[model samples]
Target: MEINKKSQAGSLESSDLMVYVEPFNEIKIEVESSVSSQHTEEIRSLILNELEMRKINGVYVKIQDNGAMNLTIKARLKTALLRGAKNGN
Candidate 1:
Protein backbone atom coordinates (compact mmCIF):
# COMPACT_ATOMS: atom_id res chain seq x y z
CA MET A 1 0.00 0.00 0.00
CA GLU A 2 1.10 3.55 -0.54
CA ILE A 3 1.82 5.63 2.48
CA ASN A 4 -0.26 8.76 2.08
CA LYS A 5 0.92 10.57 5.18
CA LYS A 6 2.79 10.27 8.44
CA SER A 7 1.63 7.86 11.09
CA GLN A 8 2.92 6.14 14.19
CA ALA A 9 2.28 3.49 16.79
CA GLY A 10 3.50 1.96 20.03
CA SER A 11 5.46 3.74 22.78
CA LEU A 12 8.93 4.23 24.30
CA GLU A 13 8.44 2.19 27.41
CA SER A 14 11.02 -0.43 28.30
CA SER A 15 10.47 -3.73 26.49
CA ASP A 16 8.36 -1.78 23.98
CA LEU A 17 8.92 0.40 20.93
CA MET A 18 7.65 3.32 18.88
CA VAL A 19 7.16 2.99 15.12
CA TYR A 20 6.89 6.03 12.90
CA VAL A 21 6.24 5.94 9.17
CA GLU A 22 5.83 8.52 6.46
CA PRO A 23 5.90 8.94 2.70
CA PHE A 24 9.28 9.20 1.07
CA ASN A 25 11.03 8.85 -2.28
CA GLU A 26 12.72 5.68 -1.13
CA ILE A 27 12.65 3.07 1.56
CA LYS A 28 14.47 4.46 4.58
CA ILE A 29 14.53 2.88 8.02
CA GLU A 30 16.23 4.48 10.97
CA VAL A 31 16.47 2.60 14.22
CA GLU A 32 17.39 3.96 17.63
CA SER A 33 18.13 1.18 20.07
CA SER A 34 20.30 0.76 23.11
CA VAL A 35 20.95 -2.81 22.08
CA SER A 36 24.19 -4.13 20.61
CA SER A 37 25.17 -3.52 17.01
CA GLN A 38 24.30 -7.06 16.05
CA HIS A 39 20.84 -6.68 17.52
CA THR A 40 20.39 -3.33 15.83
CA GLU A 41 21.21 -4.92 12.51
CA GLU A 42 18.75 -7.66 13.31
CA ILE A 43 16.05 -5.04 13.89
CA ARG A 44 16.74 -3.36 10.59
CA SER A 45 16.72 -6.69 8.83
CA LEU A 46 13.41 -7.62 10.35
CA ILE A 47 11.79 -4.35 9.24
CA LEU A 48 13.22 -4.70 5.75
CA ASN A 49 11.91 -8.21 5.48
CA GLU A 50 8.47 -7.16 6.57
CA LEU A 51 8.34 -4.28 4.07
CA GLU A 52 9.48 -6.60 1.33
CA MET A 53 6.81 -9.13 2.16
CA ARG A 54 4.20 -6.42 2.08
CA LYS A 55 5.58 -4.93 -1.14
CA ILE A 56 5.85 -1.59 0.61
CA ASN A 57 8.24 0.97 -0.88
CA GLY A 58 8.96 4.66 -1.04
CA VAL A 59 8.44 5.19 2.64
CA TYR A 60 10.50 6.25 5.62
CA VAL A 61 10.35 4.38 8.91
CA LYS A 62 11.77 5.28 12.28
CA ILE A 63 11.92 2.83 15.10
CA GLN A 64 12.61 3.76 18.68
CA ASP A 65 13.29 0.48 20.40
CA ASN A 66 13.52 -0.13 24.10
CA GLY A 67 14.63 -3.72 24.17
CA ALA A 68 11.44 -4.86 22.52
CA MET A 69 11.00 -8.43 21.35
CA ASN A 70 10.60 -9.41 17.72
CA LEU A 71 6.87 -9.96 18.04
CA THR A 72 6.29 -6.54 19.54
CA ILE A 73 8.30 -4.89 16.83
CA LYS A 74 6.33 -6.65 14.14
CA ALA A 75 3.07 -5.70 15.75
CA ARG A 76 4.03 -2.06 15.99
CA LEU A 77 5.31 -2.01 12.42
CA LYS A 78 2.10 -3.54 11.17
CA THR A 79 0.05 -0.94 12.97
CA ALA A 80 2.18 1.91 11.71
CA LEU A 81 2.04 0.66 8.16
CA LEU A 82 -1.70 0.38 8.22
CA ARG A 83 -2.08 3.80 9.72
CA GLY A 84 0.22 5.33 7.14
CA ALA A 85 -1.44 3.67 4.17
CA LYS A 86 -3.75 5.64 1.97
CA ASN A 87 -6.63 3.30 2.48
CA GLY A 88 -6.14 3.05 6.22
CA ASN A 89 -8.55 4.63 8.69
Candidate 2:
Protein backbone atom coordinates (compact mmCIF):
# COMPACT_ATOMS: atom_id res chain seq x y z
CA MET A 1 0.00 0.00 0.00
CA GLU A 2 1.06 3.58 -0.50
CA ILE A 3 1.12 6.09 2.26
CA ASN A 4 -0.32 9.35 0.96
CA LYS A 5 1.01 11.54 3.74
CA LYS A 6 2.44 11.57 7.22
CA SER A 7 0.60 9.84 10.03
CA GLN A 8 1.39 8.53 13.47
CA ALA A 9 0.11 6.22 16.19
CA GLY A 10 0.81 5.10 19.72
CA SER A 11 2.29 6.99 22.63
CA LEU A 12 5.60 7.69 24.35
CA GLU A 13 4.56 6.30 27.69
CA SER A 14 6.52 3.58 29.39
CA SER A 15 6.24 0.19 27.71
CA ASP A 16 4.80 1.83 24.66
CA LEU A 17 5.98 3.25 21.35
CA MET A 18 5.10 5.85 18.81
CA VAL A 19 5.09 5.10 15.08
CA TYR A 20 5.08 7.51 12.23
CA VAL A 21 4.59 6.82 8.56
CA GLU A 22 4.90 9.00 5.49
CA PRO A 23 4.92 8.77 1.74
CA PHE A 24 8.30 8.45 0.12
CA ASN A 25 9.98 7.33 -3.05
CA GLU A 26 11.66 4.48 -1.28
CA ILE A 27 11.22 2.54 1.90
CA LYS A 28 13.18 4.01 4.76
CA ILE A 29 12.95 3.34 8.47
CA GLU A 30 14.42 5.27 11.35
CA VAL A 31 14.17 3.95 14.86
CA GLU A 32 14.94 5.63 18.17
CA SER A 33 14.74 3.36 21.13
CA SER A 34 15.53 3.33 24.78
CA VAL A 35 17.30 0.07 24.06
CA SER A 36 18.73 0.89 20.69
CA SER A 37 22.09 -0.74 21.21
CA GLN A 38 20.61 -4.04 22.20
CA HIS A 39 17.34 -4.29 20.24
CA THR A 40 17.61 -2.08 17.20
CA GLU A 41 18.08 -4.86 14.72
CA GLU A 42 15.30 -6.93 16.18
CA ILE A 43 12.86 -4.06 16.18
CA ARG A 44 13.77 -3.09 12.64
CA SER A 45 13.29 -6.63 11.49
CA LEU A 46 9.90 -6.80 13.09
CA ILE A 47 8.74 -3.60 11.44
CA LEU A 48 10.07 -4.69 8.07
CA ASN A 49 8.34 -7.99 8.34
CA GLU A 50 5.05 -6.31 9.13
CA LEU A 51 5.34 -4.01 6.17
CA GLU A 52 6.34 -6.85 3.90
CA MET A 53 3.35 -8.85 4.94
CA ARG A 54 1.08 -6.02 3.91
CA LYS A 55 2.94 -5.43 0.64
CA ILE A 56 3.74 -1.87 1.68
CA ASN A 57 6.36 0.10 -0.19
CA GLY A 58 7.64 3.55 -0.98
CA VAL A 59 7.20 4.94 2.48
CA TYR A 60 9.26 6.21 5.36
CA VAL A 61 8.71 4.93 8.87
CA LYS A 62 9.90 6.37 12.14
CA ILE A 63 9.60 4.59 15.44
CA GLN A 64 10.18 5.85 18.92
CA ASP A 65 10.22 3.03 21.37
CA ASN A 66 10.08 3.06 25.11
CA GLY A 67 10.59 -0.55 26.01
CA ALA A 68 7.62 -1.81 24.07
CA MET A 69 7.14 -5.43 23.16
CA ASN A 70 6.85 -6.95 19.71
CA LEU A 71 3.06 -7.00 19.85
CA THR A 72 2.89 -3.33 20.74
CA ILE A 73 5.25 -2.43 17.96
CA LYS A 74 3.30 -4.42 15.44
CA ALA A 75 0.01 -2.90 16.51
CA ARG A 76 1.38 0.62 16.41
CA LEU A 77 2.85 0.14 12.97
CA LYS A 78 -0.40 -1.26 11.67
CA THR A 79 -2.40 1.56 13.18
CA ALA A 80 -0.11 4.23 11.76
CA LEU A 81 -0.22 2.74 8.29
CA LEU A 82 -3.96 2.44 8.32
CA ARG A 83 -4.44 5.96 9.54
CA GLY A 84 -2.04 7.37 7.02
CA ALA A 85 -3.61 5.54 4.16
CA LYS A 86 -7.13 6.41 5.16
CA ASN A 87 -6.62 10.06 6.01
CA GLY A 88 -4.00 10.75 3.34
CA ASN A 89 -1.80 12.01 6.15
Candidate 3:
Protein backbone atom coordinates (compact mmCIF):
# COMPACT_ATOMS: atom_id res chain seq x y z
CA MET A 1 0.00 0.00 0.00
CA GLU A 2 1.14 3.52 -0.71
CA ILE A 3 0.77 6.30 1.75
CA ASN A 4 -0.51 9.28 -0.25
CA LYS A 5 -0.51 11.85 2.51
CA LYS A 6 0.15 12.29 6.16
CA SER A 7 -1.98 10.01 8.31
CA GLN A 8 -1.92 9.22 11.98
CA ALA A 9 -3.28 6.87 14.62
CA GLY A 10 -3.22 6.38 18.38
CA SER A 11 -2.47 8.92 21.10
CA LEU A 12 0.38 10.38 23.10
CA GLU A 13 -1.08 9.24 26.41
CA SER A 14 0.88 6.95 28.67
CA SER A 15 1.06 3.38 27.40
CA ASP A 16 0.02 4.50 23.95
CA LEU A 17 1.86 5.45 20.78
CA MET A 18 1.11 7.92 18.00
CA VAL A 19 2.04 6.79 14.52
CA TYR A 20 2.31 9.05 11.50
CA VAL A 21 2.75 7.91 7.93
CA GLU A 22 3.29 9.79 4.68
CA PRO A 23 4.35 9.16 1.13
CA PHE A 24 8.03 9.10 0.27
CA ASN A 25 10.40 7.94 -2.43
CA GLU A 26 11.94 5.55 0.02
CA ILE A 27 11.04 4.21 3.39
CA LYS A 28 12.18 6.44 6.22
CA ILE A 29 11.40 5.94 9.87
CA GLU A 30 11.78 8.19 12.87
CA VAL A 31 11.01 7.11 16.37
CA GLU A 32 10.80 8.92 19.67
CA SER A 33 10.10 7.01 22.82
CA SER A 34 10.00 7.62 26.50
CA VAL A 35 12.22 4.58 26.92
CA SER A 36 14.30 4.91 23.79
CA SER A 37 17.51 3.89 25.56
CA GLN A 38 15.93 0.54 26.28
CA HIS A 39 13.29 -0.28 23.65
CA THR A 40 14.24 1.62 20.51
CA GLU A 41 15.44 -1.32 18.47
CA GLU A 42 12.52 -3.47 19.48
CA ILE A 43 10.07 -0.76 18.54
CA ARG A 44 11.69 -0.19 15.16
CA SER A 45 11.65 -3.89 14.49
CA LEU A 46 7.97 -4.09 15.26
CA ILE A 47 7.12 -1.24 12.92
CA LEU A 48 9.27 -2.60 10.11
CA ASN A 49 7.75 -6.04 10.52
CA GLU A 50 4.26 -4.65 10.25
CA LEU A 51 5.10 -2.67 7.15
CA GLU A 52 6.78 -5.61 5.51
CA MET A 53 3.88 -7.90 6.30
CA ARG A 54 1.53 -5.55 4.51
CA LYS A 55 3.90 -5.04 1.58
CA ILE A 56 4.16 -1.40 2.40
CA ASN A 57 7.14 0.61 1.26
CA GLY A 58 8.23 4.01 -0.04
CA VAL A 59 6.86 5.86 2.92
CA TYR A 60 7.99 7.92 5.83
CA VAL A 61 6.92 6.85 9.29
CA LYS A 62 7.17 8.78 12.51
CA ILE A 63 6.41 7.21 15.83
CA GLN A 64 5.88 8.88 19.16
CA ASP A 65 5.85 6.34 21.90
CA ASN A 66 4.82 6.76 25.47
CA GLY A 67 5.73 3.48 27.08
CA ALA A 68 3.48 1.39 24.88
CA MET A 69 3.75 -2.38 24.80
CA ASN A 70 4.55 -4.39 21.69
CA LEU A 71 0.94 -5.26 20.98
CA THR A 72 -0.15 -1.67 21.23
CA ILE A 73 2.64 -0.60 18.92
CA LYS A 74 1.65 -3.16 16.32
CA ALA A 75 -2.00 -2.24 16.50
CA ARG A 76 -1.28 1.44 16.18
CA LEU A 77 1.00 0.90 13.18
CA LYS A 78 -1.64 -1.23 11.51
CA THR A 79 -4.24 1.39 12.16
CA ALA A 80 -2.11 4.15 10.74
CA LEU A 81 -1.20 2.09 7.69
CA LEU A 82 -4.84 1.27 6.99
CA ARG A 83 -5.80 4.87 7.34
CA GLY A 84 -2.98 5.90 5.06
CA ALA A 85 -4.03 3.37 2.47
CA LYS A 86 -7.55 4.65 2.55
CA ASN A 87 -6.31 8.16 2.01
CA GLY A 88 -4.24 7.03 -0.92
CA ASN A 89 -7.21 5.41 -2.55
Error of 3 at 41 (Å): 0.9
lDDT of each: 0.93, 0.88, 0.86
RMSD of each: 0.8, 1.9, 1.7
lDDT of 2 by residue, 9-74 (tens): 999999999999998888899999997667878999998898898788788999999999999999
Residue-level lDDT tens digits of model 1 in 15-89: 999999999999999999977778889999999999998888889999999999999999999999999998886
The regions of model 3 sitting more than 4 angstroms off are 86-89
Report clash pairs, candidate 2: 6-89
Candidate 2 overall Cα lDDT vs. reference?
0.88
In model 1, the runs with Cα more than 4 Å from the true position are: none
Task: Return the clash pairs for model 3, or none.
Answer: none
Q: What ordering of candidates by TM-score runs from best to worst? A: 1, 2, 3
Q: Between candidates 1 and 3, which one is better according to lDDT?
A: 1
What TM-score do all the candidates reach, one by one? Answer: 0.96, 0.92, 0.91
Q: Worst ten-residue run, lDDT, model 3?
A: 80-89
